[model samples]
Target chain A: MADESGVLVLGDSTGGELSSMSRELLTAGRKAADDLGEELAIGLLGATLDQPSQQAISYGADKVYAVTHPQLAQYQVDLYLAAMEALCRDVSPRIVLIGRTNEGRELAPRLAFRLGVGLAQDCLEISVDAGSKTLLANRPVYGGNAIAVVRCNYTPQIAAIRPKVYEPLEPDSSRQGQVVSFPVELDPSQARSQVVNVVEEAAEGVKLEDARVVVSGGRGLGGPEPFKDLETLANLLGGAVGASRAAVDSGWVPSSYQVGLTGKTITPEVYITVAISGASQHMAGCSGAKVIVAINKDAESNIFKEARYGVVGDWEQVVPAFTEAVRELTQS
Target chain B: MPVSIAVLAKQVIDPEMPMAAFRIDADAKAVVPPSNIPPVVNGFDENAVEAALQIKDSQEASITVISTGTSFALDVMKKPLSMGADELVLLQDDAFENSIDSFFTAQLLAAAIRKLGGFDLIICGRQASDWDNAQVPLGVAEILGLSCISLGKKVEIKDGKVSVERITNDGYEVVEAPLPALVTVSNELGQPRYPTLRGIMAATRKQPTIWSSADLDADASQLEPRITLQELFVPVRDQQCEIIEGDDAADAGRQLALKLREAKLI
Candidate 1:
């Protein structure tokens, strides 16, 4: 082997199954490994690992390093960071990919700082230069107003890929790979944050990313009352309601309603935006949708440019009619 | 014992600026601020400040705001003070121009934190609006060996530990950490309190304690950038939209719904 240098995917799990973000990271990891002609290894932290390890392999990992410990079951910066640092030191991989999940948002920077290397956060694309073997990435900046291409100067370069940017590889059950229980001596005393309880917002139980259709509103909605109209339409269409950053910032809606670069990233079958001017940041979160339908008053609004179908009209008059039509069409 | 809290805030170009006015200075490898609009405190940083103010509201605590940058808008940076922060500290220096690298920024901020010791907690925004790196708070925690928590919408201090209602993909989880921890807050904390006229007058009467790179213990070599910016530009899009037309706005709305039904989008 040229060296112990390869791509390592920092895998995560939810409810014992492989997390979607982890699967997507494997996609990016597999790409770099293929380009570099090196093994694609995944590092997963948990109390149990047999199933998640195999799942990672089925998603294209050639090897799985399960960093196992009793306290490692959940994510804590003090404990998880220690284990990841130990794992990185042992594997000595050339590239590390972390999903920009809640955990990754915290871990990637700390990991990069701990390793004394560099990180490109919230990257939408990553590639390795063939000649120099340098890792490069395209990341959105200025709230996704622009894109910046960055390069890492130090070894074991790290990146936290934005979720939904890369599609997950289809699982191949017959695909065989090796898994090793990479043990770490975790100190419970060193840990700081303790998870008391995980409570799901009941109203948001219908996840936006999982929805087939999403009807979203923005500043043009005027106030929170209009969101009820959007909710009516979404329910009629069997979808969810989303809000632009403006609406969320205006206190017209909770931030959970927001969908943008800083908010949530959703890839639905159909995205319907109402009275929303599509900012690049907002588009970044929903551009992957199969079809985008925009309803706005401004004909010159940017949402039209990214949408497949659009209506230029006041949302007040348009939304109610749209809801009625959706109800009639679905009822019949 | 009264708790000592440090809130880290940054002044950034108004993210609310019209997209058409957003520009990239390829020659400088930086974003060119729109001349007509003034920079404001980053949106998320205001949330962090709100988190601190909420804690202060319930307990006997002192809030000290800190910011490290090449320069800052005095009024903008003082918004935290007007919102109830007891004191302000500005780590303004040319050396921070290398803040493009989170490592440098972290080292400098950590050094300043160390110099202003006795802080039981450090709160920062989940990420800044400009670079959107979301790295400095975690980096500072790493450099200072502090316990770190991210994406907290609700934060409180009790039983000698800080507990945060952390935002997750599905919902939120209640997390507790011991003192000397770092917490990053997001917009879910709700809008920051508006500065009252009386508070504004008091803030106007107050002056911030300023520090430079030389005031900290960090060395020159420790601030070298690990990441390099190769290029900066706006992404291009070319999707041509089909405008649905009808007799009136209401008709167009119906037509749009019918269009979606035809495309099997629903």
Candidate 2:
């Protein structure tokens, strides 16, 4: 008999490779499944998901469901929704976990709505409630000022977990699991919105999320020119350049580089914030950094309160000298 | 025929509330509304209204603003009206109090839209500032079975088709969809315009059409929230500061670099 009680994880893939976030979800799902004394299942939806399905099992999924079709190559909201909804109705899992990526954020809500269930988005933590045998999702709210623990009263509890919050388990190559191929019929005419083109922004160096060291600037930089200096510092440290929402809104940098509640959450080893008065919103994203360094002309800036090290000085005078010193130190 | 559009708006706690004053009651599992800070229209929802207004400015169109909440302050509800929306439809009922997740919220809003009859387009914020779920627009689109374009930074309508610049993880994609579709506007659309004095005066004379759960024949039990708040708490940060001493600005920079190197950060 098909397992009626299991934790179902949605595996998202891009460019024919399983996303790291999907792996993290599997790790989290494994823990939740262990707690509930249930099985862990993963669902991969795309055109050709053979490799990803095997990878899901290796990461700890006991069973993998691969839903494939020609129209499923690129993510179409309606198409993915229909396939997942069908799979959920057939399997009837107790909990559904999805990554809070662009695709996951778009899919989780619609799936929950279709199933007449509740969804918690961008959750920081997920755990099983021992008493009710339900899932508890902890998420940041009020622009990251507070945390709320929420539980789904209905079955098939759904949640969208944030990337990097949970660590993925090391894949065991020898692990074996069942792979089920579920085929679904998709009508091309049903898709109203089609992706015309996906243009990747020409990014240099490491991505903000993966960077070990991050050098971020704020409105205090005055203009976009000073960001080049921050980039130089980031390059010298082998890190990536980030920005505050103000700087991005000021047209100094692209939204991709923004670090805050509305932007990307980064947990680098060292976070150097320059010319940025630390707003609670910006700090919410980078608070997990091991060390925070603030450089601003204002000694009383809010950033200093949150920083482990504070330097009261103009960024123009401090950043260049700091960049040169780092170059020399790294060279030695 | 002139284009008819419905822009979804929401009233939320002030996002700009200072951190020092922000508080949550763990016992109540609710955010304690800071007495000084009053609830306002969600910033992104206003951006959705702005997107609608821009379209109305270029062509002959009618814009109706809609919201679903238990008790919406009139001042907050009138914001879009004061910003040039032709009508406001509010779904307010005791049945919607304290519960109703985004799914049910969308279902109720969709029912109201259907009752409104003719609408060529529906626009909403990518997400609300409070829950930050970014789900309702997609949920509404799903319930209505309409083409949905999300994270739209730029939207335009011409000849029964909509063109949008949709924000993606990498960058953005230019997408086109047919009429009667829903688009979730992002902050990239730019700041919503402030209401003019004339617009505010005109709004004073307009009364919003209020509907209860019974009005839409919504199943009361189906409207119950799927997710329940278990607990609310403030996160504590434990860190101590170490000021990097220097002779001057450049010296401080040097000292900071040396300290980072000693810590094996660079």
Candidate 3:
């Protein structure tokens, strides 16, 4: 499949499956490709293909390319960049999409710099300019205080899309697509950095990103002890516990629990904020939530402005009562 | 020989400013600076300085702080020095004003680093607060052919290599890169150290070295901007929060839960 001049999603199959972010990229890619009247191709690079090639097709990829190399087993910036640069050059896709993920945050920039093109990072939306057929990206800046619409002046424009902003298409198992093996030579020695150990701090139930309900706390929670109450509420609702950057910076919670522009971007069905001031940066992470609930002593908090439901009260007085009520309701 | 470290910091509009003060001059396609508050060094960049200073705390390392912009508030730019960095270098020019192009910013910074060579490590913030490009450091590493490890919550130099506890979604990975590498730090690294009176006094005595495109043999005329801003505006929120009222705080809590349940949100 030498079909070029279309959209290419630099999909990630880190866990031997299509990542949710990768799937989100497809939904965004499909929209952009459809708008531009171009084909959408998805590329996966790793030592082992996650069988996500078929998964990519089901998600909306018209063509799938798996670029594999021994050195590509894990995300080593040098090898991934080399393989991806080679893949882009060979396919010459007009526009490329990468998830604004932890690895993608590094990979996208390096790849763009390598390709000698421009990349709009952490974009909330990617639109097609009909007349120019170029990619226009809207990204949050100044800690999500404002949104800037940006355009790539050169071909092979790149974008790192924030996860949770776009929903993935439901998979159709009956869909059929061919997986092309694009060969990219990579020498393991070319890798400049190596990961010697990985520590898993989040080894419990209800991953933050996958949670439907999220109860978050902030500096106003006073100390780490209050997190237990939030966790209790989250557990009752079968949700996850989150934190504001202030909480994380205060060492009351781990960085993994932080929700903000510089932290994790999550979209839950029911997002409850406890005592958070709702900085625009914090709002950037949870704005995609279907509904927001803010509980703060100060009614003027920016979070209430973005929330669907709110209460003006001290978290110490309100949270336990809310938790008890949620528990009672869930038990019934 | 003392290990040489280059720390890249940026001064940006305060990210902590109130939402109401965040106004975009639509006609200018720029954010209007709030008059009440002044700009500060990017928070993550402060983390980078702390990371470098931590290395200095344990080992013999000379830290040189570099910042590029159309202008500088010298006092804010000298923050790293006050925090115990050895030297300060400012890359300022008229062309750098309202610079949204991360690639060009990286190019100029890379040129400055090249002009002041012999550095074993380069440290920068994960991203700037204004543009949030998160590209300049990595772009510089790409141009300099240096190994780059990003989002380091804990950075240490050992065995003549940079070891970083790189933050991942669920946890962190211990990544190691050889010398002459680049690393970007985040807030997870911990609060940067407060500038001591002694350190601040020393910083007052030391003068910053200023450089422009002319000072460094970097080409700027031929380069095209990597990103062009089409529009800048505050995103509107259509949410109308129903503030659940009650006689007391606990009653309000109970009422809010019932409201959510009534709305089928719970």
Identify the leading candidate in terms of TM-score. Answer: 3
Comparing 2 and 3 by DockQ, which wins? 3
Backbone collisions counted per model: 0, 0, 0
Question: Model 1, A83-128: lDDT tens per residue?
Answer: 9999998999999999987678888998999999889999999998
Please, what are the lDDT tens digits per residue for candidate 1 over residues B1-266?
88999998888999888888888888898988899999999889999989999999999999999898988889988999998889999999876773457888888888889999848999999888888888999889888988878899899999889999988866788999988899999888888999988889989999999998778899677677889999988888878899999899999989988988898876
Query: Residue A257: error of model 3 in Å?
Result: 0.6
* Model 2: how far residue B239 lies from native, Å: 2.2
Candidate 3 clashing pairs, residues 3+ apart or interchain? none
Arranged by DockQ with the best first, the candidates are: 3, 2, 1
lDDT (Cα, tens digit) per residue for candidate 3, span B1-266 = 89999999998998777667778889899988899988999999999999999999999999999998888989988888899999999988887775678988888888899999748999999999898889999999998899999999999999899999999888899999999999999999999999999999999999999997789767654257978999888877778988999889998998888888898888
Worst 10 residues of 1 chain A by lDDT: A200-209
User: Chain B of candidate 2 versus the native chain B: what TM-score?
Assistant: 0.95
A176-208 per-residue lDDT for model 3 (tens digits):
777898878878788889999999887278999
Fnat per candidate, as a fraction, reads 0.86, 0.78, 0.87
Clashes of 3: 0
Chain A of candidate 3: what's the TM-score? Answer: 0.96
DockQ of each: 0.70, 0.71, 0.85
